[model samples]
Target: MPKSLKSRGGEEELQCGPVFTVFAMGTRMTFVTEEEGINVFLNSKHVNFELAVQKPVYCTASVPKNIFFTLHEKLYITMKGKMGPFNIHQFTGKLIDELHEQLGNLGSHGIMDLNILVRDLLYPATVNTVFNKGLIPTDKGELQEFYQHFETYDEGFEYGSQMPEWLLRNWSKSKKWLLEVLEKNITHIKAYKSEKDNSVTIMQAVQDVIEMEKSELIPNYALLMLWASLSNAVPIAFWTLAFVLSHPDIHRAIKEDIASVFGSAGKDKMKVTEDELKKLPLTKWCVLEAIRLRAPGVLARKVVKAVNIMNFTIPPGDLLMVSPFWLHRNPKYFPEPELFKPERWRKANLEKHAFLDGFIGFGGGKFQCPGRWFALLEIEICLILMLYKYDCYLLDPLPKQSDLHLVGVPKPEGQCRIEYRKRI
Candidate 1:
């Protein structure tokens, strides 16, 4: 049934009933899109985030079953603590240096795949920011290759989750490659961190929580963090920049806004500050709008305890799923369900910048993505830097999302080439 939904493109498959039901491989799942059901799906104490994600998290990663529950919950807190504003503020400048380093490799005028550019920029910034310098190769070309392997591993994630890992040998290899690298990074940091820079990394924090004898779990946990931090955020970055560049008005307005805060764009590097980054409403809105349109089509959580939603009583063992793609399309909350209007955010019913109804791009409730602010800030930084340092326009039509996948930020269906000239 999930395959049927994945094989078929567009909304018709998702619009079947008030509460859609799917029976796949002995798993019973209920999908919710309406107001009450959606709230319960997101906010219900019965919904279990770790358990729902356990299948995929275990399948794709090397994390052993015995420690999955403890490691998953512990790392959730680790990620939240490591990516919170204080940690992010410290790494902002370093992350920008990584981004600029990649940009430097792209000459003054060229046609480049926007997807590749996003991967090249974000993969290194995230890896280097969360890991020590020598932990992973910091060179742009090496990082690009690293992300390519991750794409291969990620491409088979859903299928791997549903089926056995041994069935997919090649995907398994990619996973191994990633884990090996992560393992080396963790081991090196733990062994030599005190002798060297002694600067703490996210992965360093991760290494601390895990037991010394349970060393096999190090890379597995590191892999989990890498996937959470980069997998969706990278594509979301692509979509955000693509959306803004597609709308000339929005692009120009955000450019001017960033300039007012960061000063005029020149050959010199951008001097970004957290306070200045906070001043960008338009840039922030465009990122939100892109996320609204291209967010994960389905997010499934386990119905741990019995919960009533949309007239149905979800039992303890069932799965509850929500579609941010369809939810954000509701005209009641978003007005124009399909159109990309960054300004709609200004008029929505928002508490603490979250839409009370219909929207859950960063997710909702206490279990919202811990890297939410960092992800947004990362996207916005990319937008401002690219927009400020270069005059970029899509050389081809904006790429569309692969309708076949629904788990996370969908990768572009094809390459969208962008031609940019470095600002004088």
Candidate 2:
């Protein structure tokens, strides 16, 4: 039998023996030929440190982790630079407490408030995202009024004639919900009482930091927080449930891991302690694999300034995107890149490479999502509950990718149906 794999130098190599090996960038692939085809196992050494230092982003060949790590370190410095880390942590804790208390006994009213709160967090960032895309100030007032009168769909359409049809449709419904909650909640109502209120004040503070402000600030920031909650969490829950329903071995592994963590403690209750949740490694790995395969936003970078590279020059104003979807599949890095293998993450030395330039599932550099830690924890919590309690699967086969792009994230075609069964 002949076995073939890409060598470390990226050249194809063939071995007539049962096992053939290819080496590249500190990792080697050993292929064993079988009647059906070849099964390959990947092993890595320590050349990642050098490879990372050589891979260029913005024309600088710094170690990728160093770039991400340094950017985050500076973000910490700049964010808390004024108030101090302790104070920032305290503020975050306070918000977490409030959010937890509100979510604790969620009724319809509470859901409305929660939705508003999420929107408030989203508005500023959301506006900034659009504003950065060239939404001008004159456009801002009409946009604000469009959202204000959004509940009256026809009125919103009449007022927002300058906006695109899709934007108008999306915002009309969203603004109606926003107004409903803001009208109900004293906090939100007061937050934007006047153009000069604390909402604007807070928006200015955010603007000072993020460097943009439109009347859309509140809505945009609210959208940012909402995206963090919805974009990853929703899809992850769907896939986790689908995979658990279809893969019993994986399901059993997750259940056993969860059981071992909170044994006899909370069999019936949905709540588990944070420490106990961290012990579910198998569950974490399942979600990681799912996200690696399914994450929608390819990491985005815009050239803020132009520079000359070794051979050529990229002019300023060019946008650059690096996708983990492809990089994660590069046969040189992952031996069966398409296979769902969670253990790859748990294996030592893998962590060192997981967050590098090519492996940016959550994005990379200073601008990477600050809420990643919270996002991961939330995902783990939700996955544990679903894996422990329900059996689920896709009602339809995996749909082909579509053209609907929301803030660079993909939207599924219409609605997806899934079948769920109670697990015994």
> What local distance difference test score does each model get?
0.77, 0.41
Tens digit of lDDT per residue, candidate 2, span 73-149?
A: 44344433323322222233223332333233322221222213332332332333212211212265754653344
TM-score of each: 0.91, 0.53
The lowest-lDDT stretch of 10 consecutive residues in candidate 2 is 35-44
Over 234-293, each residue of candidate 1 has an lDDT whose tens digit, in order, gives 989998889888889988888889778877778466767878877887777788888888
- What CA root-mean-square deviation does each model show from the true structure? 3.3, 13.7
TM-score of 2: 0.53
Ten residues in a row with the worst lDDT in model 1?
1-10
Leading candidate by lDDT: 1
